[model samples]
Target chain A: MRRLLRVSSFRAVLVYLGLFLASTGIVLLFLHGQINRALTSNNDKAVWRDAAMMNQSYALGGLSEVEKLVAQQSQLSGVGVYLLADGLGRYIAGNVPAFPAPADTQMQEEGWLHLRLQAPFAEARARLVRFDDNLVLLIGRDLSAQQATMADLARSFFIALLLLAVFGVIGGGLMGRQALARVENINQSLRAIISGDFSARIAPSSSQDELADLEAQINQMLARIESLMLAMREVTDNLAHDLRSPLTRLRARLEKLSLSAQKTGQADDIEQGLADIDQLLSLFTAVLNLSRMEAGTGDMQQQKIAVKPLADEVMELYQAVFEEAGWTLDYVVDKAATTAHIIGDRHLLAQALINLLENALVHGVGSPPHLTLSLTRRDQQIIIAVTDTGSGVDDHQLAHIRQRFVRLDESRSRPGNGLGLSLVDAICRRHGGQLHLSNHRPSGLRCEICLMVRE
Target chain B: MRLLLVEDDPMAADLLIDRLRCDGDIVAYAENGEAGLAQATQDAFDVLIVDRLMPKLDGLTMVRQLREQGADTPVLFLTALDSVDDRVAGFAAGGDDYLVKPFAYEELRARLEALMRRKQLAQDTMLTLADLTMDVIARRVTRGAQEITLQAREFSLLEYLLRHKGQVVTRSMLLENVWHYNFDTQTNVIDVHISRLRNKLDKEFSAPLLHTLRGRGFVLQSADKLGDL
Candidate 1:
């Protein structure tokens, strides 16, 4: 709940609503004060007007003025009857309860007014008029009904203000909730993005607000980063594959140069030295091949070929070599995937397999040497198993062996560039699968080509 | 042996041409792939060394064009770039071999010699060093008239070394030619086989034919002539 209010805009909305209610209360109070003043002024004006007319009637009458005034007041209820009191505070004719006389003396303060909360009799007043000695006039009126009406008006105003307050609160809460929901979505996306989901993207909002623009900018940044990462990987891999070929050639010539140099003949020594230079030249030759692969601008004729046919062709070609070496070579193919087609460049695949075969023959010679090639479908995946009962590689160290130019100590005794397994691994990854290495029975490494079965 | 060199880099071409001529192969230079292809097509050259990427026509295209025109000449690319795809592409385009540039003249001469030998199409087609003789076509080996039986890998390794006779064959070279390893991997396969080859070629012979240059490579030559080098 507190998290919702953490938003600056939400707090601003709360402050705005609070001030709105406070201002409404202030305005209502001002209006109430104005109504009170108007009511009091109207009552005072009515009393003054009635008194003036009453005085005129009394002044016009010769002897029955008191009786006439008494007859006028008889039609109005709550309008108290009154007549002039003698100068000694004696009421000649009035409805006011006569208070006990103060000491038989006339009231020194003549124009005195009195008000009280009585239902029928509310206000009274007396004033002295100097006429041929000393005369006095007294009047009274009830104001209870007027007070009750004013109280009723105040109650109704409060009820109306209460209704306004309720509506303001509900409307304000809904508006705040909607605004908060929009902000929360953006925050959630940012949090997810920071957690390392480069694939994550903010939902494009239709609202043409500053937040929407921000989301667009963030998405663009993520795209650039992803592409750059891909580009960097391409560069590194191409360097590993392309750079080492010439180095392989150069190293070959160098070894030969050192060989000829051992000859006692000076000509042979010079020729041998020149051979070292030959290796260097060869090293400089095929460097651009990696760049070409990375660019992917080469021939676009990738095709699917049966693994058994290709494997059979390579095996037959090398069959004599293996036979001459006095080693047993066995081959098999499952009926289901008899001629399972693997999609790729034929020569590249041949080369990839050639590496695996060479690794086996050279590394497989010491321990009950036997080379077996088989193809099968397992778990909806096309698996080509190449097992050899020979000097098996350690599974723990197999991962490093796949790295370019990283031949293991045991395998290095045999002739090879370390790129064999690297190429194999690259081909597998490109094909949307990977090479699985495992131990075979007795003493041998089994290379399982874990490839995607053609859908 | 006259060789046609097609390279765009004037300085590299001149230096290589001069060095190759010094090493005894007749040198002919072409500034661009087009000129080189023209020379290679018209002339009777023993070996054609090309730069893969060149103006007027790329090395691969030029080679492919030559092959299309019925020229079965050997081609070798000289470039700064080295990638399996590049080499494969060049080979697919009908190139016989590829060499990355910034190279030693010695390595250049060896490839050219190999190309020349291949061009000559030697009748015997044998791997031989001094009294040691191994016929690759017959898959037979005879050390001074005594037949020596060798494994397939051993025979292939010996063939590769014999192909570039009078040179130190590095582990990498044997790997590529014999084991077909294009990536430079530190593998004991080369060393183990070389050790075995030394045993086969020298253990019973009066003069050991295989000499291991410590920290360098193995050299197959007349044991009588092998000096401290």
Candidate 2:
């Protein structure tokens, strides 16, 4: 509900409804005031006209004539009240039993008297006239009918307002939910694309609206991106094929030369040439693999892989090498990590772990070089960390190592082509995971491959 | 050994043919996939060495066509397309082995030998080279009267070496066959493992059965018989 309220479209609807209801309330109140004034004016005018005729009747025939006119007028109009009283305030002839008490009479503007009377006629507006013959005549109209009409108008106005509010809220809620659902659909498609499904696109909507137009535009953009990515992949593959062929021929020739030179004096130099060719080949292979992985064009055989066994296998492959190098290598699997499973390509994940282990073997040179390969589960992620007790990278250089061919070794004497960490990073991203490099407390560099655990 | 070489580059083909001819093999060469397929279909070669991208028909399609015509010749793909997907595609097209280009000649020779030997050794329950014997059914290895206990990985490594006894077995062969890993590690991890296996198999023996061939690879053969080659 809160999310629905946050939607701009739904909020607009609420704002419009609020303004509409406020204006409706103002208009209804104004109408109510005008209706009341018109009815009261009509009542006051009827009383004034009746009083004028009673005054004329009294002038022509004194008290008897006035008394006759009052009785006749009271019987003719159902809502009329007429009264003739003696000089001592005693009622002589009238529709009401007696004149109203002083407390029940309120003097209105312009000689109008508002009376709260008893039974049948609940209220009245009257005018009092005094004669020279010691008589008083009162003429007024019953205001019960006008009060009832006013009450009815107020009730109808409130009911109409309530209906408008109920329908507006319901309609607005539905509109907000619809807009939210469409937006969610677009978000889902975008997320799929982000996760390496370049073909994902938002479903076309039926209704013609701004959101529908946006969806069409997004789908068009996705198509364009997908085609461009396909073109890029084709170019990369062709380049790899074209470039590696010449390199292969060169290496083959070198190998041949090395074989013939074995009987000659410069066999060592030829062998070194062959080794250099092999190094170049390896560098080529690594760069190609990294670029493919980074572009999300690498083949991924995704399956549910048990974390412990994968880690153990990589550790086993390196355990002997570490022993041979006179380095202490430790493998630790947390209880949770043992059972944790991740959806990824086993070959690539194994390659990533091997890269980290190799990184440690080459650069991790402590007094007695120690390397730890540990797997632990944290929240929804399975972390495989390779920590080496060596001189950690300088704080500034740590971030640079993962970039392609960025070597921290200033002398450039290292055997690596500086693509191992970059390859590991690309592999991690291809698996929808991340590679985090941080310096271990005190000393050493720690590289962690954090992958999402399969449910 | 009889082999068919189907590759586009004449220079690379010539170098391969020269070295292979020197190694005492009968070689047949084709410059394109069309000519290669025609030659492969018309002849009975021990193994076929094919490059993936070629004129007329690509290696994958040629191999597919060859298989469709019921030829079961062992095939080893030698190509510059080294991605995992390309490897898988090669195998899917009826290739028995996949080797990336810019490869060591010894690696190619060893792989071809392994491919040619595959059919003959498929159902062997026991593998033996001289006095060293492995009972594949019982999972046992013995040198003469002495029994050798091998770890699981070491045992598989030994099995692979024994399967291709007297032939050069590269480090990558061991890693791929024994550990089933396709990617290469930066360090000499495989060498260490091989050394460990060597220690167990020949440390106390009078004759060293496992011999490292330096730049070439490792070969499991009796040292006394090595000079006969």
Candidate 3:
């Protein structure tokens, strides 16, 4: 119910219903006023005609003729009521029994009055006129019909407002629910796709509506993505097959040569040859893994992962490596941050951290490689940073460091194939995170991986 | 060790067989998976090296068949596909170990030796190399009545070395079998750990049991010992 109210269309329905009721009320009021005016104007015209007739009778024959005329006219079956009285305001023969209080005496001005008639006490609207000799007359009409008409109109307005509210809300709720369901369906399919199910696709309907058109477009896009993923997998497989075959044969031949060379008492060349081959193999493996990660088709499993333990394990693995490389390595895990967990492949996370630490150790060698690895919580994310006290990259070159094979040194004398940071960046992105490289103050590099704490 | 090498590439197979023979192991070569499966079932072999992609029958199918037939010979999958998913698939198909193509001969030899040694050493509760002794269940190491203090990870590292005492254990083998890491790090992290282990194992003793064989790997044996197995 709360979710339904949150739908924008439902809110629009409420606003529209309110507007409809207000306009209907205003229109009904205008019509009621116009009808009442027309009825009252007709009554006033009839009263004036009867008053003129009474004046003519009084002129022709004195109060006797006026009295006789009032008596005859009052007996007629019509809306008008007539009254005739003397100078002392005594009621004479007429339909009305007595004059109403504060009756007008002026000949030109007509006084309006409300009066009750015979049994059942029907209400009437009357006007008064006085003659030159203090003879007064009253003529009026019944108002029950007009009043009934206005009551009926008001009742109809209320019924119409009730119906509008009922239908508007019901219709709006149905439409909002339908739209929400369609959007949720699309969202579910998209989520499945993101979780490594490439075959998942939005189910489209047969209707030619806008929603169906959108689904169709989405399905087409997914098809393209699946094909592209397949092509990438094929390329990686083919590259592995074509290149590693010859490399394998070469290594085998090198082993044979090394054995024969050992017999001949000259084996240093074989050692150098084997070292170069190992470097090539490592480079090959790193590049292949980097590409696989970038392609978003890696065998990564997303599970609830605690960040502190992962950080500690990688740091432990690299601590002695740093010491052997003549660098002092230190690590601290914020206890408060240990509770933060993420959904990602555990091995990938550990590997990315190891790469960053190794990068610092390798490049930070020009100075004494004093490194600090820290894990902390930052705004719905866990930040794992490796800071090295060594020369950082140039400001302009920082942007290019995460690109493939983009070593900054012109000499290219470094042991890496320049894909370490790139791989870390790819792994971070795969986990819905990011890799940030910044210069630590007092001359050093700070590499951090920020992973979201989804829970 | 009698080893079966199932590879489609003739030249690579010939070179590998020659190298294995030179190392004093009798190696039987099969040109494809069909021939390899038949040969494997007909004879008793210590280890089977099967290539992933082969003509007539693939490595996974042949191994799966071998496993179904109750052939418990240890199988190592040799493939150019080194992705984590590929490795998972290789292990899923009843492979005991996975070695990517273009591997160094020393790595291959070390892995084969480790596989053979694992079969013979699975029942042991204690491991002793020279005067150094490791009580596996008690998690204690002592050398000539002197108890050696080591961290938890260092203890496991020493245990692995003592189990494969006479064999040459390569860095990749340690990383895979002991650390359970399928990928390699840029730095030689194994070297550092081995050095620390060396310090604790040999710094106070006259005969150093842990020896670094330069480009080869570490070997745990008494210094007075002279011959390879």
Candidate 4:
């Protein structure tokens, strides 16, 4: 419910409904006032008509005739108020027992007076007429019926407004949910694409709405991107095959020459040539692997790999190397991470960890060159961290160190192709994970490969 | 030893055939899979070196056809395709070994020898080289009368070396056969493990059996035997 309320379409509907109800309420209030005025005006006109008739009677006959007319009007309709009073405002003949208003009350426009009367006539509008014999007549109509009619009008208006609000909320909720679902479909497709599924696409809706148009445009873009990626992958594969064949033939020729040169004592130079060619081949292999992994075209044999055992194997491979170098090596697995398993290519994961260890062995120089390989679980991810007690890189250089052939100034003299970290980063990305580099606390460089833990 | 080489590249094939002939192995050359398959069916060779990409028929299909015909000769796939999937496909098609392009000659020789020795070594519970003996069933090792202790990985490594005794087994062969890892490490991790195993097996012995052949690889044979070579 809260998420639906956050939808822009739903909020817009609410705003529109609120404005509609407010304007409707104002219109109904205006109509109510107009109706009340019409009823009161009608009542005043009837009172004036009665007063005029009484005045005519007084003119024709005398006070006795006017009193007889009032008695007849009172008997004909119970709603009518008729009074014939003598000079001092005492009632002579009428349904009312006494004058409703005080003697000092002044008349309103056109000789109209509003009266707040006693029991049986709650409110009234009246007009007074003066006779030549110092007699006064009062004529008015009861207003309770007008008040009742207005109350009925207000009740109906409230019911109509309540219905509008109820239906608006329900309709707006439905509209918001529909829009949210459409957007979610697009999101799910994009997420699949991000997770290395190049074929994922949003399903086209049948309706010719704006959202459908957007979906169509996105599908076109995805198809274009997929084709471009496929082309690039083919180019890389072809390049690997084309370039490696000649190199392989050259190496074979060199090996053959080196064999003949052994008796002539020229084998050392040819051996160096072979080593150089081997280095070139390794560089080619690293570049090819990195590119394929980054392009998400690398073939992965995914399986459930337990975190602790994988780490242990990598550590065992490197433990002797570390010991020979007089470097202390520590391996730790957090209790929680011991049982953590991730679905990924085990060889690639081991390769990534091995790269980190090699990076440490080559660049990570310290008093004793201590190294630590640890595994820990954080939320849904398993972190495999390698820390070394070496002088860390500059904070600015840390960001670019993972790029291809990005060796630091001091490390240029070292024997490295500088593609190790880039390969590690590519491998991590292929597994739907990430490679993070930071300076370890107190000293040294820390590299972490975080992979998602699968249930 | 007799070997058959089925490769598309004439220059590479020529160089490889010359080297293998110099090494005292009889080599048969076929320019493509079609010719190679014909020669292989007509004659008997100890090992078949098939390149993956070839004209007329690819190496994988050739090997598949060979296996379907019930030819049990060991086959090694030589190709530029180094991906895990490609290797799996190679093995699935009945190739006994896989070697990526631009590999060292020693690496290829080591793997080919390993493939040829695979069937013979499977039935042996006791592996012996010189006075060093390993009882595979008991998981015990002894040099003459001294009982040797080895970690699980060290024992496996030594067992593989013993299986390929007197043969030059490259570091990659050790990694693949012993550790079962397909990727390479930047450092010489295998050398370190080998050194540790060497210390335990040869330090107190009169003759050093475990030997490192510099750029070639490692071999397990009596020092007298090595001097003869």
Best by lDDT: 2
Regions of model 4 farther than 4 Å from truth = A1-159, B130-138, B142-147
Candidate 3 lDDT by residue in tens digits, A1-455: 89887877677877887898789778878887888789788877887788888888889998889888888987887766777877787888677787654342222334677775663236677777787666888777777876887788778877987897789888888988887788788989997787666889998866678888898899999999999998998988898898999889988888778878987876888778877887888888788888878877767887889888787777777788887778877787787687889998888888898889888887866466699999888888889999999899898988999999998777999778889899999999888789999988888989989988977
Model 1: per-residue lDDT, tens digit, A1-455?
47657766667766887788788778878888888778656655666666677667667873268445755674556555354555665655545544323442134233434444233455433333322234454554455666677788778878877887677667666766766787777677765444333456778888888878887987898677657656764665555435544453444454444445566546455555555554433333212322223233222235777777777766755554565577788888888777567666666566667668878877777545788888887766778788988767777886687776677765466555565676676666555568888777677888877776654
What are the iRMS values of all candidates? 8.2, 1.2, 1.2, 1.0
Task: Pick the DockQ winner.
Answer: 3
Candidate 4 C-alpha lDDT tens digits along A1-455? 99898889999999999999999999999999999888888887787778788878988998889889888888886678777888887878988888865753446777777677887888777777788657977788877888899999999999999999999999998999998898889999997787667888999988899899999999999999899888997888778777878988999999999989999999999999999998898888888888778877777777999988988888887899999989998888888899999988889888899999999998987777999998999999999999999998889999999999999956488878889999899988878899999998778999999999998
Report how far residue B98 has shifted in candidate 1, in Å. 1.2
Tens digits of lDDT, candidate 4, B1-229: 7899999999889888988888899999998989999989999999999999899999999999999999999999999988889999999999988999988988888787878888888889999988899999999999898899999999999998988888889988888888889887778899999999999999998789999998889999988888633
| lDDT value, residue B163 of candidate 4 | 86
Instruction: Give the whole-model CA lDDT for all candidates, comma-separated.
Output: 0.65, 0.89, 0.84, 0.88
Q: Judge candidate 1 at residue A192 and give its lDDT.
A: 49
Judged by TM-score, which candidate is best?
4
Compare candidates 1 and 4 on TM-score and give the better one.
4
**Of candidates 3 and 1, the better by lDDT:** 3
In model 2, pairs of residues that clash are: none
- Model 4 residue A18 lDDT? 94
TM-score of 2: 0.82
Candidate 1 wrong stretches, greater than 4 Å: A1-426, A435-449, A453-455, B14-26, B38-44, B64-73, B81-85, B102-105, B125-130, B135-138, B167-173, B211-219, B224-229
Which residue pairs collide in model 3, if any? none
